[model samples]
Target: MTDQAHSLSLPRWKEPSILPGFGVGVGLTLTYLGLIVVLPLAALAIRPWELGLSGVWHELAAPRVTAALKLSFGLSALAALLNAPLGLLIAWTLVRYQFPGRRILDALVDLPFALPTAVAGIALSAIYAPNGPLGSIAAKVGIKTAYSPLGIFIALVFIGLPFVVRSLQPVMQDLDAEVEEAAQTLGATTLQRVIRVVLPALAPALISGVSLAFARAVGEYGSVVFIAGNLPMKTEIAPLLIVIKLEQYDYAGAAAVGLAMVAISFTALVAINAVQTWFAGRGRA
Candidate 1:
């Protein structure tokens, strides 16, 4: 058989590589990630090792540090959980519906990205303080929001909401509506269609959004400080504790607390990603 004839017999889907860009792209990607991500993380891990095991444990187990850890991790989880459903609805609305001021509403979701954390903190505090309009209304109802744990939760929510919305927006946009229609044709109820078809497809993106929100909230500082009142052992977040330690020239202590938060966030993120991947595999199957 001739070479040309042999080639013609091959399937159209089989194409020989005629370009050499793959190696260059892969090498560049690895080098960039190594420099920007792996190196800094390695430094963070190594710095705390300079302190002995006893020193590290004591630093991390200090009352203030422990409280800060709880505040940061606990509040971040709560904020992400709160954002998940609302963000899903927002994403669905943006993708599935058309209304007046739709563009403005879409733009508003990204406001937190452009707005400074300090400005957001101040704005929230002003609006929610006892003397402010909203605060006065809340005060009449015996609820205090600003300068409290609630304030921290609100700040975290403000910043984290966008992550989930933006992450799911594209996924929802690309979702196959035909599948839902087919399911409905088979007599599946709306809830069953969502649970059996839509939710499975959106799971990866939703999990990604949740993880991003949690990570962002965990390390947040400026937005939380003003509203949380920086109260020790009560409303102080882990990032704020790190700042306090830095202010007092306690580098070792600051590093310890920062390292602990980093570790926890990293582990949680890993778990979320694993779940996402598992769901994606099942979806593909």
Candidate 2:
């Protein structure tokens, strides 16, 4: 056959199959992705366009809007930061050690994810209601746990923790114990072994977990509203503000806030991805 004929006759793509052909798989995947992700995101992106640029700017720059945005982003970041170490420790204990009720402890780590956010929020509010046990202790120190920004942070931490723990658990499970044993055999101290051997291996996964938790916390609403007291410019989060705007029939304002939050979360996620890349590179280096 001529080279041109052969080239023309060459297969271009996989043929459809009866059970699970590449064509069927790819078609189904694209269809599902379009319906679930792409369409909704396109609608969201187009929403603020109904507002002129100036209108969107004014909506986002309003005092109440700015305060809610700042509170939401700041508390989410703080909660994710706090979750990193605690989640890592919990994941490590779960992965590395087998103790009494270890299976129960592991199962409980997923409670935040399984529990309804509204129920979690109500439970947290009850626990931190000033007359509640933990709330009473916090009050003794003159710290308000509920109906304040602190309460938002606490609720965010509660909901965000599961992300970090779940993200790290599988990675930690795949890590080899022999590597640590070898490091110790070479006279590496505990701190040195952890720093030089363990942390670099875990850094990428840890950052990813933190980023996931941060993103989750940023958009959290149900579990946060009860604890936030819904005070405008005080404890109200961005999601709550968006809901309030929607309730007041200020659709454009809500869209503007939603767009701003998407922008902020995307920026933070990109920065976190860069950090993850750096950690991955350092591990190779």
Clashes of each: 0, 0
Candidate 2, residues 1-285: lDDT per residue as tens digits? 986676677675533234766776789999999999889777777888788888888888899999999999999999999999999999999999989999999999999999999999999999999998899999999999999999999999999998999989988999898999999999999999999999889999999999999999999999999999999999999998888889999887888899899889999999999989999998888
**Candidate 1 on 1-285: residue-level lDDT in tens?**
987887788886454447767667779999999999999877877777677899999888888888889988999999999999989999999999999999999999999999999999999999988998898899899998988899899999999999999999999989989999999999999999989999899989999999999999998988888889888899888888787789998777778787898789889999999999999999999
Task: Output the number of the lDDT-best candidate.
Answer: 2
State which candidate has the highest TM-score. Answer: 2
Task: Output the lDDT of residue 140, model 1.
Answer: 95
Give the per-residue Cα lDDT of candidate 1 at 117. Answer: 94
- What's the true lDDT of residue 262 in model 2? 89
Candidate 1 lowest-lDDT run of ten: 12-21
